[model samples]
Target: MTDIQLNMDGEPGWEPFDAPALVGASLRFVSGDRTGNRFRMRYFRNASGELVARVWFGPETEGPPGHAHGGSIAAVLDEVLGLAAWAAGYPIVVGNLNIHFRHLLPLQTVVQVDSEVVAAAGRKISVRGRIVLGDRIFAEADCLCITLPEEQRRQLG
Candidate 1:
């Protein structure tokens, strides 16, 4: 394991991301799980204008000894990728999530999640993302999201 410094605050080339009012209030499953209490996510836009998140996997996310649980990693990917779609002007709900875990993420370390909107066709939006620590990749995901009906979206808000 390489020694990596964790910075909770915003770093250079990244700006803080404020979740839209409704999404911030309605998000409760993974991003706001009280029992899991596994992550602290700070959203940002990198210099190139891609969606990014800095996430800290806390102690409660442990699964394999000192590493973060697979579920935790998946949750982060789900939310960040969905948000990436939203940032790209799509109103969506994740229809399917496919994640590949490459390495065990150490607990209490801050990792970067970089996301991009890849495609859009009718109601479907495709987004790709990854969780990385310096040069190491912990996980990567491809998400398929379905745009919500305008009426249903209003109901969510």
Candidate 2:
């Protein structure tokens, strides 16, 4: 389903769509499973209009015997960065993503994620995102999203 089809009703903000709902819907769109029980992601608007989302990794997302999986971290980065672009009013596909793994993130701990739009050129959008635990950063990513034309996005459906 497309973004329009996944439109959630009666959102809290109720103006330009709730950021958390939008992210949750997009996660459901990509992952195909909405636990809706635990491991919630909260959203809020920054001064620059970027929608930030945070997820606390726990029993729900585990790998490597004890900590979060590498893929899971990337997924969160990509999702948040893409949502950053989409929230900026430019829907796009993943182009390139580079992440730096700094620390071993513990499971069942709160990990903060923040994404912001840096620049847009034609069909490309550059964004930056980071996953942080308290004052320490676990991973950081810089992504390039390929903006799709209306026709291309339509074809994906």
Cα-based RMSD of the predictions, in order? Answer: 3.6, 7.2
lDDT of each: 0.84, 0.70
Write candidate 1's Cα lDDT for 1-157 as tens digits.
Answer: 2223246556788877875552766566555643345777777888888889888888988999999999989988998999988888888999999999999999988899999999999999999999998999999999999999999988776
Give, for candidate 2, the lowest lDDT window spanning 10 residues.
Answer: 2-11
Q: Which candidate has the top score in lDDT?
A: 1
In model 1, where is the ten-residue run with the lowest total lDDT?
A: 1-10
Task: For candidate 2, give the lDDT.
Answer: 0.70
Q: Which residue pairs clash within candidate 1?
A: none
Task: Give the TM-score of each candidate.
Answer: 0.88, 0.76
Candidate 1 error regions (>4 Å): 1-6, 20-22, 33-37
**What are the clash counts of all predictions, listed in order?**
0, 0
Candidate 2 lDDT over 1-157, as tens digits, reads: 6332232222354333265454344465323343332244555566556666656665656777778888778887887788888888787878899999998887766567778899988888999999986689999999999988889767655
